[model samples]
Target chain A: MNATQSLRQDVPEQGGRRPGGHGAAAPRPRPGADRDSAYWWEAVGEGRFLVQYCADCRTPRFPAREVCAVCLSLEWEWREGTGTGTVDGWTVTRRTFHPAFEAPYTVLRVALDDGPALYCWGCLVGADPDGLRRGRPVEAVFTDVGPDPADGGPTGGGAFTRVVDWRLRE
Target chain B: MAGTGLSGAAALAGVGATPLSRDSGVSTTALACRAILAALDDAGLGVGDVDGIATHRVGDSSPPWVVGPALGITDPAWHLDQFGGGGVSHAVIGQAALAVAAGVADVVVCYRAINARSEFRMGGQGRAPAGAFDLQYQAPYGLLAPVQHYAVPARAHMQAYGTTHEHLGAIAVRQRAHAAANPRALKRDPITLDDYLASPWISEPFRLLDCCLETDGACALVATSAERARDLRRPPVDIAAAAWAGGHSTYSPPAPGGLGDDLTTSSAARLAPRLYAMAGLGPDDVDVAELYDCFTWTVVVQLEDYGFCRKGEGGPFAASEALGIGGELPVNTHGGFLSEGYVHGINHVAEAVGQLRGDAGPRQVDGAEVALSTGQPGHILAGTSALLLTAGR
Candidate 1:
C-alpha cells in the first residue's frame, strides 16, 4: 500500500494507546464538531488540512467562525493548507490531566505558513521534542484515531477519523 | 481619556472570605452565604439592604437566584450571574458598581464561591463540557487544562524575551515568603528558589509551583454609593475606576496579519490606559497592586502591560526587589493566587481592599493609599478586568 493508504488504514487501538508503554490509556476524547466545523473534520478524515477564508476579504481563520473578525463579512470558503508551519511556541506535558494522553508528550503551537497569521495546536510526532525551538519549521501529518465509544459512532465514513500531528521539517 | 462617570461613584465598603482550605466540606451555596453575611456585617448593613447581587462562575458555583433568597433577599433590584472564570471577577464588581451608580440597586454584593479542590476541580474530568465549542480544537490533543493553555504563552514569553525559569521561580519564591505572614494563606510555608526549581513540572515551562493552588473557599465584597459607604463600619475603599476589555480568544485564530507576537502581550496592555484614564491615576500613584496571578508568567506580563515596567522587561522586573512589601511597588501583598488561595481572583480583590483599609495585619504595605486589583490577565481568554481603588480619607 502507498504511505497515504497505510496511514489511512491505521486505527488507534482500544483506549487510544500511545506508542510508548506508559500504561493502559483511556479513550481519547472526540472533538465536538458542530455545524460550522463538521466540514473541517471531514476534510481531516481525508488527510487534508483545511482552513476557512473570508470569501470577500480573503482573510484566513480557524476553529470555524460565522463572520470575518476583520470585515464582519459572512462570506467564507475552505482552502487546503500547505501542511507546513513554524513553531511559534510549545510545551511538554509532564503531567497528564486527561487519561487518554500519556505523560512526556510535546504539544506545539504552529503558525501556519500558508495563511498570513493562522495558528493551530497538535501533538508532536516523529520528531525529537528537544529539537523544538521558536521559529522551527515543521509540517503536519495525519493520524487515525478510534471509532470512540464516547462518540457513539464514526464521525467520518469509516471506523476511524484522522487528526493532525506535527514533525520537524528536514 | 473620557471618564467612565463611574469614578468614585461607588465604594467597596467591606470584604469578607472564608478561611482558605483544601476542603471546606460544605456546599457552594453555604460558602456563598457565609461570605455574603460576613461582608454585610463588615459593611454594617442588613441582609434586607442588599438589593443587588452580582457573581461570575464557570459551572462550578451557585448562582444569584439560589444564593439571593437564601440570604433573605426576596426581591433583588438587579442580579447578574456571568458565565466565566477569573476573566469576569472584576467585571462583576464593575457591573455592580454601575448598577449602584445608575440607581438600579442600592446595595450590591459581589461574591465568588468555589470548591475548586473538593468539587468541580479545575483541570479535573468533565470540567470542559462537551458543548464547549472552543475545546473541540484543543481537547482532542489533550490540551484540556488551564496549565496547558497557559504554558503556550509562557513558552512564547520565554522565547521572545529570554525569560528564564529562574525568573518565574523568583515570583513563586517571593509570593511564598509573603504568604508566610498571611494567616489565611493556604500554602504559608516559605519556599526558596531551590524549592521552586525542584518542584515537578505540571506542564513544561510551568513547574508545580508556577501554578496557583486550587482551594475550596469563597470571597465577597460589598459595593454601595459613596454616601452609603461612609456610614458603614469599615473604612471604604472607593472604586476610583473600573475597566474591562476583551480581545481575540486565545483558542481562536489570531487577527488577520497579526502574528503570534501578540501572544506575549495580554489584554492588560489594551486596558491599562483606559483603567488609568477612568481612575485619573497613573502607575506611580498605585501604592500597592493585587494583580491576578493565575500563573507566575501572568504576573510578569501584567507588570509590563500595566506600565509598571517596559515591555519585555517583566522578567527582570519580577525578579527585582520591587515586588516586596517595602519595594517601589509591592504586588500581591496577600501572596496572590500563587501563595494565597485562588478564589478565582475575587480573593485578590479582597486582599486589595484589606490593604487599602489598613486591615491587613502583617503583609500589608505600609501607608498604602491607592491600590490596583485585577482579574485574570487575559492570557488564556484574551478578556481581562481591573479596578483602581483609593482609600477613603
Candidate 2:
C-alpha cells in the first residue's frame, strides 16, 4: 500500500544516453523562463526565436521554467540561437480528438547540444519527406504567422512575430 | 467498510449508458446527463432521488453541483469526485456503495463523459497545458505525452519477456474483431495484425491503430442498498465483492528490485488475491471479462496482473485464440476501450451488467455471472475492483 506508487509512472530519463546524459543535459521544462518568458513570447512576436540558459552552466532551457534543471541554478539569461536542431523522433497525427491541431500535423522531438531533448509542433521547412531521419539537420522557419494577440500582445502584429513555440533553424 | 461512519452495505441496483459511439454529435454535457438519467430510470428512480454523484472528471464539464441540478436533483445529500487514477473510479464506486449502505443516501450515481474528440486530438497527449510537476519529467526527451510515457513500460515489457510486437498485436486483432460485432462500437470493422504493424509509428513501438480511439460519450450506474435493489425496475445485480488498492506487495516508488519494472505486476498483482478472496472465486471462475484496453499491450499486462495469466506468460497466453468466442474465456465482449468507446471503465461495467442480464445479444456470454473491470491511469497503479454480479446473488 505504498501510496507513492499510485502516482503516474514514466519519469523520463533526464536526458539521452542514461548516466552520462544526466551530467548536464536535463531538459528545460516548457514555458521555462520565469517572468522573462515574456521575452521568448515577445521574440516569437517578431518571427524570431530564443531560449533561456543557465548563466552558470550555459545549458539551454525550454518551455521556460523558473530555474535551471541541471544545476538547479536560478540565474538565467536569454540568448539567440540559429533556430537549428536535430530530429530525434516525430509523429504525423492523422485523426484529431481536438480542434486546435488540425490532423496531419507533425510533432517532433528535437535535441540541442546543451539543452535536454525538446518536443514541439514542427513543420519541415523544405525537404523531401522521404529523407526525414533521426539526427537529420533541421532549422526553424518563422511561420510568419505573427504573434497571437491573445498571447498578451497585438493580433499578428509585430516586427518579427516570434511565431515558433520551438522550431528548428536549418 | 473502513469505519468512516459508513458500513459498506451498498449494492449496485442498476447500470446504463447511451448508445456507444465515437461521435454522437451531442455535447459531452448532454452525454453525461443522458447516462445519468438512463441509470436513474433503469433503477426505477428519478433524478430527484439521487443525493450524490461521482464523475471521472471529464475535461471542461460542469462540477457535481451543476450536473445534479441540471439533471433535476433537488438538493443532493451526497456528492463525490474521484480522479487522478483509472482505478480510483472503482474505489469511488465502492465508497458510494458504502455511503448508501451506511444510509448516507438512497442512491449514488457514478459517471464519466468526455469530448475527447475535441480535447485529445492526439491520443499521445490531451489538451491540458503542461504543468511544472509533469513538465519536469516529460518535456525532456519529448516524453511529455502520455502515450510515450506508457510506451516506456510497454517497451520494458517487451524487453523483459521477449514478447514480440506481434504478440501485442494479437490483442488488437481479437478485440477489434469482437468490436465488429458489437452494434454500439465505433470501429466495428475488423483490423489485422498486419494492419497494426503496417500502421505508421506513433512514438515507436506504438502504431496509429495500437491506441484507443478518441471518443465523446458518457456512462453511469445507480448503486443502492441490496434491500432496496430488489424492488428496483431492472434486476439488481449484487456487487458481490469490491476492493481497490494503490500499490503491489513489496512495492516501491521506482519499483523496488526492478520486479515492478517488468510491467508484469503492481497495483493489480497485489490487489488480485484480495479481489479473489472477496469474490470467493479464483481466476478460473470468471466466465467473461472486460479489462481496460487503452493500449493493446495493457490488456496483456492486466491479464497477468489480475491473475488470469501468469506474470511472464501474458504475451504467450493472450496469443492463444481462446480469448474470443469459442475460446477458453470470452473477453472484451463489448470490444473493450480499443474497439468500443472509452468512457473510463464505466462502459465495461455497463457491458458486464448487460452480459449478466443476458441482454448482450451477440456478444453475451451464456450465463455470465462473474465479471471483472480494471484500469490504470497514467501509470497510477490502483489494483483491481471485481464485481461478482450473478443472476442470483
Candidate 3:
C-alpha cells in the first residue's frame, strides 16, 4: 500500500467500531453540522468536495453560508471542487489539541485552483513539511469516517462520512 | 475633524486590576468585585455613584449583572454584558463611555474578569460550542487553539514580506526587557533573543514565548463625563477615540466579491484610520502604543496597519530600537500581554491609562501625552477594537 493509503487506514474509519463490536476505540470529535452545512457534509461523505455558488452573482463561498456575502442572494447551488489547490499558508502544530491528532502534524491553508481565491484548511498528509511554501500546488484526498455513534455523525446516519486533507501534487 | 460626537465627551477616571497570575484562587465574581471596587476607590467614587456597568466574556467569566449586585449596585440605569473575547475588550469600554457621554448613566465601570488559566484555558481542549459556524470547518482537523489559528497568518506575513524568526524574536526580547521594570508583569525574568529562539514551538512560527500568558485576573476602568472626570482624584484621560471593525478572519475565507483578505494585514488596518480620525490626531501624535501582543506577529502587523510604519515594514520596525522606552515610539510600555499578564487586552488599556497619567514610573515614556491601545488584531476572531487616549481632558 502507498503512504497515503496507509495513513488513511490508520484513521478510525468506522468511528472506532470493531469487528463484533467488542472493543470500540473512542470516536473522534465530529463536526457540528447544522441546516446550512448539512448538504455540504453529505457531499463530503460521498467523496465529493463541494463549494457553494451564489445563484445570482455566481460567487463561490466555502464553509457554507445562508446568504451570499457579495450580493445578499439567498439562492445558491453546489459546485463540485476540482480537488486541486495551492498552498497559501500552513502551520506545523507541535502541541496536541486533540488526542486523535498527534504532535508534529502540518495543517495547510490552501487556495482552491477552481474557485476565486476560496481557501480551505486541512491536514497535509503524504508530504514533507520542509517543502511547504506559498503557492505550492496540492491535491485533495478524502478519507472515510463512519457514522459517529455518539451523535449519529454529521449526516445523521446511513451515509458515507468523509473528511478532506491534502497531499503534494505528484 | 469632529468625531462621532462621542469623542472627548467622556474620560477614563480610574483603572484597576487584580494581580495577574496563572491562578488567582478565587471565583471570577470575587475578582470582578475587587477590581471594580479598586477602580471606584481610585476615582474617589462609590458604588452609589455608579449607574452603569459593562463587561465582555466568553462563557468563562462573570457578567455585569452578577458583578453589579456584588458591588452593591442593585439597579443600574445601563449595563452591557457583551459576549466575546479580546476582540471586544475595547468595545466594552467604548460602550461604557457612550453611556456616560449620552447621560444614560452618570458613572460607568467597564470590567473584564476571567480565570482563563485556572478555569477555561483558551488553548485547552474542548468541543466547539453550537452556532460557531466557522469551527465546523476547522475543529475537525484539530485546529482548535488560537495559537494554531494565528500561526497561519503569521506564516503568511513571513512569506509575503520575508519576515524572519529574528524579527519575531526581537519583539519577545524587547517585551521581556520592558517587563523587567514592571512589577505587575508575570514573566519578568529577562529573556534574550537566544532564549526566545530556544523556546519550544507550540505552533510552528509561534514559539512558546510568542504566546501570551493564560492569566487569571480581572481588570476594571471607570468612565464618566469629561466634566466629572476632571474632579476625580486621578488625572482624567480623555477617551479621544474608540473604533472597532470586523472583516474576513483566518477561519472564514475572504468573500469572493469583497476585498480580498491580505493575509499580511489585520483588522487593525481598517480600524486605525477611523480611530485616529475620531480622535482628531494622527499616528505621529501617538507617544506610546499599547498595541495588542497576543502573539509577537500581532504587534508587527499592527505597527504597519496603525501607520507606525509602511506595509511590509512592520518586521523591520519591530526589530529596530524604535519600540524601546526612549525610541521613536515606545510600544507596550507595560510589557504588553507577552510579558505583562493577559487580562485579554483589558490590562493593555489599564497600562495605557498609566502611561498617559505619567504613573508608569520607570517604564513611562518621557512627556508622554497620547497613547494608543488595541485589542486582538482580528487574526482568528473577525472583530477588532482599539482606543486612543490623551493625558488630560
Candidate 4:
C-alpha cells in the first residue's frame, strides 16, 4: 500500500489558521479582495471564516471562485463555516516570505467538512512531535506568528500565538 | 527496423523560439500558437496536415481544438498536456512519437511558455539563501534557498567523495562556452573556470554562474514519422525512446510524517532502464547527452543516476567536461538550460535533434549518431524524463 493508505486513524490535523481564538482584534489593510473574492475576504474581516456557496447546488467552494469548480454553476451565495477539515497535505517553511514573519512555519491544504478544499499559507503549529495526519478534525484560528504591527493578525508578535483560523477540535 | 541497430531514423528537423524579455507583450495563448506555427513552417509542414499537440504541465494552456482552429487545422488526432511541472519538455516528445508510431496521428508538436518573469516577479529577488522548502523545516536553523538546498547535498557529497567546488566550476565554464556560440542564449558572456570561481557566492559553494537564467519565452518542435518525413521539406527526427517520472512531492503524506524517498536516488532511476532498453542501447553506447542542468549540480547528479558513472564520481567526471566535444560524452552542446534558454527542457530536445540531423551550427557534436536528453526537477527525487534520437530511418 502507498504511504497515505497506511496512515492510521485518529491522527490530529489542523489548517486554515491556528487552534485557539484571537478574541477580537482586526488589523489594518485587510487582504483586499481580487478576482471575485470580495465576499470571502469581507467575511474574514468580520471574524467569521466563510466560503462561497454555489446557489445552484448549495455546496461550499473555496479560493473564492465566481463559478463552482464542481457544478460550474454561476448562481452563488455566502455561507458561514466552522472551518473544520482534515489535512490533505502540508509543507514546513523554514523562512518567511517577508522579514516581518518567522521561518519554518507550516502551510496546509485542508479538506473542509462543509465541502470545499482550501489551501492556506500560514503558521500551523508549535514545535510538537504529533504528526499532522491525513484525516483529523481541525478548526480555524488566527495567531501572532510575525513581527507585523497587526497586534492581532495571524502570527503578529513572532511568538507561537494561536488564533482560531483552525484547530484540532475534539 | 526491428533490430535496426545503427540506423539513425530521427533527426530534430526544426527548432523555434519566442523572445526572452521581462514582459513578453503577448498572451500565453498567442505565444504558443506562434511558436507552434513557426516550428511547422521551420519543418516545412503546413497547418492543414497538422493533427497533434503536447505541452508542459506548468505551461500556459493550449487546447488542441482551439489551437488547431487558430492554426487553421481541423480534427487533430490527439492532444495532451503533461504536468511534471518544469524540466519535462523533452520527455513529452516521446508521447508525441507514440501517437505517430501507432498511427494515432501523423504529426506531433510540443511547446512550452511561462510568464514567470512577469507573474512571479522573480528578478532582483536577491539570490540569497531562500531556504524556500526548508523555511519551516531547516531554514530557520539557517538552511535556505536553491543554493542552500543544493549546498546541503554538495557538502554531504564532499564528505563522501572529497570533491571540491572547483570541480563543479568546470561544468559552468563548458556550458557557457556553448552558449557563447548560440545567438539565442540569454547569457552569451564568455566565461572560464577562473571566472566561475571568482564570481561571488549566492549560497555556499554555488556562485553566480552555477544557476540558470529564468526567461519569458516559448519553444516548439514538429515531429512526424520517418516514412512521411522523407517527403516533407525537413527530415523528421525519429523518436527512439522518451520517458519521465517524479522524484518526491513535498506536500505528500510521505514527507512530513514518514521517511520520504531517498534524495540520493533521482527521478530518472525509475524510467532510465526502460528507455535504454527500448532504444536497444545503454548509457555507454550513446554518442552524446543533453542532460538538464537547471543548476550545475543537477547535471552531476543525473550523470551518476542515469548510469553514466558510479555514484560520487560525478563531480570529478564533470571537471573535465567529459560530456563536451572530444570528451567521452558531449552534453548540452546548446549550453543546456544553464546557459541556453530555459523553456523548461524543450530546448534540450531541439538541440539533440539539431546534432543528429547535422543542423547544429558551430557547437555541434561532430557526427553525433545517438543523442540522449533528460530532465529532473527536485535535487534527489526528480521528475525525470529521457529521449533517444538518431539521424535517419
| Model 1 vs. true fold: TM | 0.93
Ten-residue segment with the worst summed lDDT in candidate 1 chain A?
Answer: A13-22
lDDT of each: 0.83, 0.61, 0.82, 0.60
**What's the best-to-worst order under TM-score?**
3, 1, 2, 4
lDDT per residue, candidate 4, B211-326, as tens digits?
77766777888877777777777656666766656544332222222212233445666667777777777888778888877678878777887788888888888877576776
The full ranking of all candidates by DockQ, starting with the best, is 1, 3, 2, 4
Query: Chain B alone, TM-score of each model?
Result: 0.96, 0.89, 0.97, 0.84
Best by DockQ: 1
Indicate whether candidate 2 or candidate 3 has the larger DockQ: 3
Candidate 4, residue A38: how far the Cα is off, in Å: 26
The TM-score measured for candidate 2 stands at: 0.68
Better of 1 and 3 by DockQ: 1
**Model 1, B89-201: lDDT tens per residue?**
89999999999999999999999999998998887555533324666667677787889878988898998999899999999999998999899998888889999999999
lDDT (Cα, tens digit) per residue for candidate 2, span B222-277 = 88887788888776666766666554211122222323323345566666667667
After superposition, the stretches of candidate 4 with alpha carbons farther than 4 Å from their true spots are A1-170, B1-13, B21-23, B59-66, B120-152, B250-260, B377-382
DockQ values of all predictions: 0.53, 0.07, 0.52, 0.04
Please state the CAPRI-style docking class of candidate 3. Answer: medium
